[model samples]
Target chain A: MRRLPLYLMLSIAALMVLFPLLVMLSTSLKPLDEINHGSLFALPQDPTLAAWTKAWGGACISGTCRGLSVWFANSFAIVLPALFCSLALGALTGYALSLRTARWVDMLFAALLIGLFIPPQVTLYPMIVLVREMGLFGTLGGLVFAHTVWGLAFVTLLFRNFFLSVPRDLLKAARIDGAGFLATFWHVMLPLSLPVCAVALVLQFTYIWNDFILGLTFAGPGQQPVTVALNVLAGSQFGQQEYNVNMAATMIAALPTILVYLLSGRLFVRGIAAGAVKG
Target chain B: MQRVHLQGIAKSFGATKVLEQIDLTIEPGEFLVLLGPSGCGKSTLLNIVAGLEQPTGGRIHFGDRDVTDLEPDQRDIAMVFQSYALYPTMSVRRNMGFALKMQGLSTAEIAAKVADVAKLLQIEHLLDRKPAQLSGGQQQRVAIGRALVREPQVFLLDEPLSNLDAKLRADMRVELKRLHERGRRTTLYVTHDQVEAMTFASRIVVMDKGRVQQCDRPEVVYAKPANRFVAGFVGAPTMNFLEGELALLSDGPALRLKENLLPLPGLWASRGLQVGQKVVLGLRPEHIGLAAADDVGTCPGHVVMTEPTGPDLYVRIRLAGQEVTSRMSPGQAPSPGQKVALELDGKAASLFDVADGQRLN
Candidate 1:
């Protein structure tokens, strides 16, 4: 008898959290007329694949009907490069900061940690000017570099904490066995860092793929990621409001990060626990 | 064979000096144990030898080469940490072979060497198992195997057996000694376990407060400790100390305790004794015995406690307001709260200057 209220409360809370996603899905499948006339909670009266097809290949914007597919490819090109570079550099920097006990390195790490609190907006103009001066502004490469820099602080911090948990004696033993810095890191340290790398990859991939601000500012029209393209498709003034198509496009833009979280959710949780817990 | 020499070694953390002017030589193919309680810098000294730590001001020599600036790998040393720092991800075999593989040795050579060492250590069957999968003793063996496969010039072990159960530790002690006997590698071992030092070390370097208290053979350090610290540290149950003054008795110089005047052995009295000078008398528990009242050299006391250990007993007795233990055969036990007479073995007794804690010759 006591479980009924708790069960009802839990269901209500879960529905509240999932309401927006469900609305998006339902509206995407509804026919244009039904979507225009009915409440968000109502089931689609004339469910059809028309909206999905239009979002995938026929959504029009400023007389252009190339759907979100072009933006999806663009987002991938930017995100993949940014994610790879940031995670790689973050892991290397973390390994050095955690393992090396030099005074300068410690000071440098302290400064980097302080970088985590800096507001991204404070440096936007200078970064834009710098990117333009480097001939990378208005290109996918410029957007990737921006994302990589923004993602580095969290990735480095995560990797550093994870590396600190590793027993120092293992590294010491490897050193005594004739392993130089890179060899020890490659054979001993990197293999032990899989859990942290998984976490960093997930975090950076999600952040870069979903990023709208940097992508909107730096990415050229041909290189704009899916988030910016979705905004353009949804809020444009020239066409009749295609609610179904806009919902479908938003769902498509969110799919990769959602899929990543779904696939590796267990690992993500475990990695966070392992990296956060003190020995 | 490889000889290690540490010269003028000093280490300081900020303003605090941890190790100061430490100098010691470990002869080739010798087992030298650095024995000290925790925070005494025994492990720090071992790390210095292994090149894992850089000395603030010093030079380390492996035979003719000055390796003070060399990396740990270039110095050719292998250490077994107290925690047995085995690679958690790798199998026991791979952990052992990792160093050899890092050295760019051929796979065939690495395999053969690993096989030989594994057979000797009796861990051949555990090659496929990870460190977490193995029991404490197995993990310990794998750690030692990892060190063994390297065939480095020096083996630095920092309290390697400290993490095992008592029975396993005792068993591993014998195994480690046998391993040393077989390989005869130049080894520097560190531990707080005095028994491990007494049993394994060809020479024991007793340390206190980051200074070398005494470095001598096990028997010599046990029988004639350099000072009060060495005397108290090297023995189990430790040596009993009684504050007293040297005085002249009818026979010779004697030690005057609170209510007892224990005569010093004549041989010690002849060396030098200033009248009324403060001194401390040292006696091991085993040297004190329970004697009959009528026996000569007997001092009467009341039994405070009795601890029985199968074949032997430790009887604590109060004499002159101080408690002293006497080891006796179990058949001749003294019960608590009973009157007893204590016999002192003067030949094994030692005297120290009260101010300096230095042993009096």
Candidate 2:
């Protein structure tokens, strides 16, 4: 059939895409000796749950064997409030920008959108100093603040483009129906923006949960998130290099984001199609 | 209901003047229609009255209260937009009762008012449904019901029926008249449809180029338009104009064409016109009738085209080196190239100066 080569190409691309994930999953099940002596692609003849248990319960980091539980809680403490604050601010800012009351509003929005381009890695130094000056360094609050600031540009852009699709007549009708600014947004605009909100929440949650540099830089030792803790576990200085445990720890650290993608995939595509790409 | 007055209203957007020195008063309980083509600033004028747009320089008074600087909610005005602008997320009951709820009315009172309006509009069965679930006609009824539930000082409708189909638009026009009669609400409607303006307006204000052309009863506007633009803009099939010069016949003053002479009444010169002055003779198509061929004193012409619309025939006649249309009864319709004579009702005709478009008599 003429479709043979096309299907072959697609099958190759899919294998390439799933190859790393399969290696991680298979490697995490092997014991240390088999992982060392066997071929890289060999199936583990004797698989064990020791690495998973150790990753969940007893992986040593910072002279402690507390595993990922503490750091997972730390990430949650940093992420939940940060997600809420960033998304709330972003939705309000986007709604205001979408109103387009004056010529200068466009200029202001352009200036704000400039933040989306400059990489957060470049701004980490200034952010550290800003967090320190505010007396938030090494605290969960500091990490939350850092993540919220980083996510604001993206979430704001998404919500602004989404709200722009609503008709001007609906807003004017609300105004004439005696709704003030806040009431109009709460009763009308908010109810219509549920899909876009889901997209923003999923995206922001994954971003904040997976962030390593911001958590390691601002979180210091006591408040470090799971990503930072996993880094410490993988790069242990005194132990033999245990690739299976490192791979298992990496899988655990990435679970939330993968789950988020699976849950919000369809709505994420809809959001991108609704002008988030332009934003 | 309250009398609404817009005094010396002027609005300019970045040097593009929209409305200039518009001063009009809408009487209490009067159904006033602002009729104009697009970009003529009719909707802008309505928005200004609704307090949605601030005028560059003006004052608006609803009854005795100056509301020029007030917000739309504070102005005691309710408006229905062209799109029927119902809140998509709310049910029909909530859509109709939103203004009352915003006014902080008790739940029972809001429910009572919304129910009353829904029943009156015959939308009681649709109360639980959203706007998207309703047909265009049903959505329009709900929009009107929303405005009625507010009981505001003024009801402003901005081309509300313009989005409906032709048959539905006609039905809505009749319903709008009936609604105004039953409620006796002071209403201001804006549309470019001359048929809607002619039928639904208690008084019609014809506007063009951001200025008022004429504001009077529809019958007066139909019989005697202030200028040529009003004459041509407000009528169906359009008024016809023939260029000629004023001359004195042996009997009296008359309009002299290249091929025929049309007699003018003696009192037509009461505006101090004289012979040899160029004028345009304005004639409605319905006023021109087919005369018997070979009749004395009749202008003979040939039909160049004919279009029959079941109820009436629009026959095109080539008369005096020009093509013009005449509305005739269907039984009297003529075929193309048929010989016929044209007769004008002199008393019902109008004349305008060749230099200016102002009416002569």
Candidate 3:
């Protein structure tokens, strides 16, 4: 009796938090006519898989109807390289900065941390000009480079904090064993950093995979990532909005990141807890 | 065998100096201990010698080769850190063999060396265990074994037994001495514990505030410390100090405490001394004794406290408003608040100039 109100309040909070996702799923399954009525709480009058298939294989964009498979491939191509390059660079930078104490390195890390709070929109026009100068605009490579730069701060900061938690004695021991910088990092530091690396991978994967702005700006029509492709599908100008197809396309664009989180959730939590305790 | 020489070593971080103009030579097969209080730069000096740290200004030599600018690994030295610093991810066998493997030694040689070291350290059964799986003492032995397999020119240990419990630390101290005896390697060990220094070091370098206060054999440093700092720093329960004036007696000179006078030996009195000169008298607790109330060479005091540790008793007596401790045999333990007479062993006493804390001959 004493805990009844607390339990009821918690349940209500849980339902409130889940309400938007439930509505999205319910509306996604609804028929076009029911969706047109705009009563989001109402279930579909007739259940069908047609909307999901249309969204997965036959969404229209700019008078062209095609499945999102091409855009999914585009997202993968852009994200995988971006994630690898960013995490690799971040880990190396973190290892160097943590082990080598120098005024210049400290200044460089300070600059990188300050870069974290800089608004992406402020760099938009200049980055575009720079990308054009490098002959990378409108290419998948350009999109990867841009995402890598954008994701570097978070990854480097995470890896740096985690690496700092490692005992300095271990690093000293490796140094005394005749390990130079690269050898120490490859053999000792890197092996000990798996938990943090997993975390960096998950974070960079989700961010780059779901990114809309950089993907939209730099990725030309031939190389547009799935998020941009889905936007074109849902926001098409000259057709009756294909409600089922748009819902299915949104789900498709969201699925990879969702799957990553579900699969690596335990490691992610452990990494964060481990990093946080040391900090 | 190798001899290490550090000449005019000085190190500073920004404007703060940590070690200044340090000079020492470690002979081949000598077990040298750098003993000091924490933050006295003993470990820093050890690191400098090991090439883990480059001195701001200095030259270091190992058997005629200059290594001041060399990296730690290039210096042919192995160190056991206070934390043990065992590779947590590797098995004990791999941890011991890592240095040799890194040097591109053949697997057969690495295996043999690791096996020999492990057997010597009594850790052969733990070869398959990770550091996390082993107990503290076991981990410490593995760390030493790792250093031993390298067979470097020198071995540096920075407070290696500090993390162990009291009993384990004592036990490991004996083991470390035995290990040093067996290997006969030129070793430089850093520790803040004086007991470790006195028990294990062939030569002890007592440091304070980035400077070597005194360096000598353990017994010599214990018996005749260079100054008040060494005298106070090198003993357990510490040497008791009393400030007083030196006065010329009819036969010799004596130290005059308020309400009590302590006669000095003829040898110390032979040195020139003014009648009213301020001085400090130093006495080890064990050298002071309890005497009968009317004993000729005794001064009266009231017992302030009594601590008995099975075989011996520590009696604290209040005299002239100052507390002095005396170590007595357990058979002579005194009760708190009891009146007693304090007898000084004049020949074993030390005298220092009050102002500068320098010894008087």
Candidate 4:
């Protein structure tokens, strides 16, 4: 067939991407001795759940044998509140800016867009100083605040662009129907923003859950997230490296984000392309 | 019903002037239509009246209550947009009842009011359907029903029928006129379609280039336009124009073109015209006819083209080195390139001065 070359190229590209994930899965299922004697890409000869059990419960991380359970709980605590705060503030700000009341409003939107270009690493020092001044430098609250601030620009940009494409006459009709700002937003605009909200939710959830630098810096003792715990478990520096437990911990830490993408991947794609074309 | 009054209304967007010193009053129960071509600021004037856009310099009153500083909801007026603008997410009942619900009326009362309007609009069976599920005509009726349920003091429509097919537009026009007769609200309508204006409006305000050219009844505007723009903008198959000088012939005064003369015998529109004064003669297509072959006072030209509809024939004539069109009965249509004697009826013609395009008589 004429399409044989195309299919061959696609299969090679797909295998290249799936190889590391396959290795992680295989290594996590093998016993310690089998992993030590086998090739990195080989399948397990005798599969066991011992490595998974230790990764979830008994592995030593940061001078404790309690494993990743507490840290996994900590990630949920940080991500849920941070995601809520960022999405709410972003939606409100984007709705207000979409009204296009004056010249200064456009200038303000342009200023917010500038925030998306500067790397978060560039602002890390200023953020640390600000959080220290607020008396929340090492607490979970400070981590939530940092994540919300870093994510605000992206979420707001998504919502504002989507809301701008709404027909102006809809707003006028709502006004004539006696709906004020809050009422119109609740009854009209909010219902129409479902796809955009789904995109923001999935993205912000994955970002906060997978973040390493901010979690390692701001999380106090006994409050570190799963990513920080996974790093400490893999690089203990004192014990002989247990490669199987480390791989299992890595897989457990990544499961939430993978599940999120699977659940809402179609909506994410649709939302990204929402306002680029009109019907 | 409330009488709507606009005084000294003016609008300028940054540096571009949109409307200039527009003043008008609509009596209670009167239908006043603002008729103009696109970009002539008719819709801007309507938006100013609706309290949707504030005028740069003006005061508006609805029955002695100044509403210039008020928001649209506070002004007690309803509008039907060109797009119909029905809420996409709501059912037809909810769309019509939304304003009443905002007023904090009970659910039972809102339902009753919505039902009454739906029944009147003959959309009772579509109460549960969303706007996207309906056809264009149904959406238009729902839009009107939404406005009607509010029972506001003033009603405004901005080219509401422009998006429909020709037959649907004509049918809706009659329906809207009947609705106006029943409700008798002080309504302001804006459209570029002259037929809609002529049929629906109690008084039509003809505007061009952001200025009011003529404000009168439909027949007067059709018969005696105030200037050249109003005459050309308001007619179909467009009024034919001939630039010439007035000459006093042996029988009477006549418009003298290059090697051709059209007799202007005792025409009221040509009163006080001095001999040899430059003027433009405007004649509608139906006013020119095929004269008897041997008639003495006729201008002769060859037919350039012929367009035949069922009841009428429009023949393009090449006369005096210019092309002119004449509307005749289908039975009287001459073939192309045939010589025809044309008769001009000066009684219905309008004479405008060549210098300023203003009516001379």
Considering just the first chain, candidate 3 attains a TM-score of: 0.93
Error of 3 at A220 (Å): 3.5
lDDT of 1 at B329: 88
Candidate 1 residue pairs that clash: none
Regions of model 2 farther than 4 Å from truth:
A1-5, B250-253, B264-267, B292-296
Tell me the TM-score for chain B of model 2.
0.96
Query: Which candidate, 1 or 2, has the higher DockQ?
Result: 2
Q: Write the per-residue lDDT of candidate 4 for residues B1-361, one digit (tens) a residue.
A: 9988889889999999899998898999999999999999999999888888989998999998999999998999999999998988899999999999998999999999999999999999999999999999999999999999999999999999999999999999999999999989999999999999999999999997778889988898989898999899988889999999887778766788966788766566446778888899998999888987766667778999999877889999998888998999998979998998888877888999898899887
Tens digit of lDDT per residue, candidate 2, span A53-135?
A: 88877888887887887888888888889999999999999899989899898888888899999999999999999999999
Writing each residue's lDDT as its tens digit, candidate 3 over B1-361 gives 7999999999999999999999999999999999999999999999899888889998999999999988998889999999999988889998999999899999999999999998898998999999999999999999999999999899999999999999999999999999999889999999999999988999999999999999999999998888999999998788999899887666556778875676554436437767878888888998788765655656678999988887878889887678988999988888998987777776788878888888886
* Cα lDDT of model 3 by residue, A19-111, tens digit: 876777777888888888768688777878888877777766655667888788888999889998998998998888886487788788888
- Runs with alpha carbons beyond 4 Å of true place in candidate 4: A276-279, B269-271, B292-296
The alpha-carbon lDDT assigned to residue A61 of candidate 3 equals: 62
Weakest 10 consecutive residues, lDDT, candidate 2 chain A? A270-279
- The residue ranges of model 1 lying beyond 4 angstroms of the native Cα positions read A1-6, A276-279, B248-253, B264-267, B292-294
Q: Lowest-lDDT window of 10 residues in candidate 2 chain B?
A: B262-271
Better of 1 and 4 by lDDT: 4
**Ranked by DockQ, top first:** 2, 1, 4, 3
iRMS, model 4 (angstroms): 0.8
